[model samples]
Target: MTTADALYTVNVTINGQPHEVKVPARRTLVDLLRYDLDMTGTKETCSVGVCGACTVLIDGEIAASCITLAVQADGANITTIEGVANGEALHPLQQSFIDHGGFQCGICTSGQIVAAKSLLDSNPSPTEDEVKEWMMGNLCRCTGYYQIMESILKASK
Candidate 1:
């Protein structure tokens, strides 16, 4: 059997829920979130890590889920895009995106929102430059990024 044939159990806390899942060692965190947990909010684009399309909060820090192996996050707390909001109440950033038109095509919105949420959690009130620097990793093929930066800054308030 190859390394991919070896399955391991990963125990993690996702969005405040405890889970024990068995997965191949090669399975990335994005796959675990999207396929196993049905958390499709975390988009997978640029399969590589640089694009930030699969950004997730692992232990309250930003991570590229597409490049992160599920086994690597064992025993950690993970917050996907789905976990950022209350049941029906939209997260401020989410609302800001809609209000400010932060997205188009909607592919990169979730990761952008999740990443911006992390920034806000760290610095509740970031300056415009900080918002741009913080969000520079997440790319949007649709918007010019001015609106996304505005959304993040506005939500930071």
Candidate 2:
């Protein structure tokens, strides 16, 4: 693809699996993850990046995949919601969410989980206020965020 065509082949490591796919230079990382690769774990609500529904970890750092371009993620290690849990045993955060009634509609659960993973990775034990502030990016319209915050804090403990 020519430079003017805005197309490029990007190699990304997703969930420890290497994937090489041709994507438009302008294609968002979320689109590539969801559409091209059939990884629907990444949710997309607000396309502009204000909402954290499209959150994912790039090299263990939280990023909004919706606004991030696929090309930008080239050669990066990405972890989506799919990567958080194993086959049957849920991640500590997931288990906490279930135990604390963190999710209601579940649309925002993916982002919440991914964000909580980022938090837990950095600080295993986070206070309730810290959990609320850290998870501010993820918005849950149905749960009112009470249960979600409780879940993250509980997981930290």
Candidate 3:
């Protein structure tokens, strides 16, 4: 293939597995995961990155996958919502979300899980207000934020 038609190969560690995938320069990380790799746990809501529905953990830091290019993820370790669970057992945050009614329609659960995982990783003992502030990037039309906050707080404890 000519340089103009060449595809870029990006080597990335996703969910603890190393992968070398060919992606175009314009492809976003969200598409790379969801479409190419079939990792559907990372939801794509606002493609513009404002909704945080495409959030993923890049080397343990939460990032907006919708706005991040797949090429930029080369040599990086990425964790999606699918990676948070331990086989059949749900992660603490996931269980908390269920136990505390953190979701309604469940469209935003993936993003919420990713964002809450970031918060819990950094501040394992976050206060109620801290949970609200850190999770502001993810928006859920249902539950009105109270149950979400409660779930995060419960998971932290």
Q: Could you estimate the TM-score for every candidate?
A: 0.95, 0.94, 0.95
- Rank candidates, TM-score, best first: 1, 3, 2
Give the poorly placed runs of model 2, Cα more than 4 Å off: 1-6
Task: Give the per-residue lDDT digits (tens) of candidate 3, residues 1-157.
Answer: 3676568999999989898999888889999998889988888887998988888999999999999999999999999998899999999999999999999988788999989988888889998888888989899977558898888888996
Order of quality (lDDT): 1, 3, 2
What is the Å distance of residue 16 in model 1 from its true position? 0.5
Best by lDDT: 1
Model 2 lDDT per residue over 1-157, tens place: 3676766999999999999999888899999999999999888998988878889999999999999999999999999999998977799999999899999888888998999999989989888778878888788888568788788887885
Overall lDDT per candidate, in order of appearance:
0.91, 0.89, 0.89
User: Across residues 1-157, which tens digit of lDDT does each residue of candidate 1 receive?
Assistant: 5575988999999999999999999999999988998889999999999888899999999999999999999999999888988999999999999999998899998899999999999899999888888888999988559889888888887
Which runs of model 1 end up more than 4 angstroms from their true locations? 1-4
Worst 10 residues of 3 by lDDT: 1-10
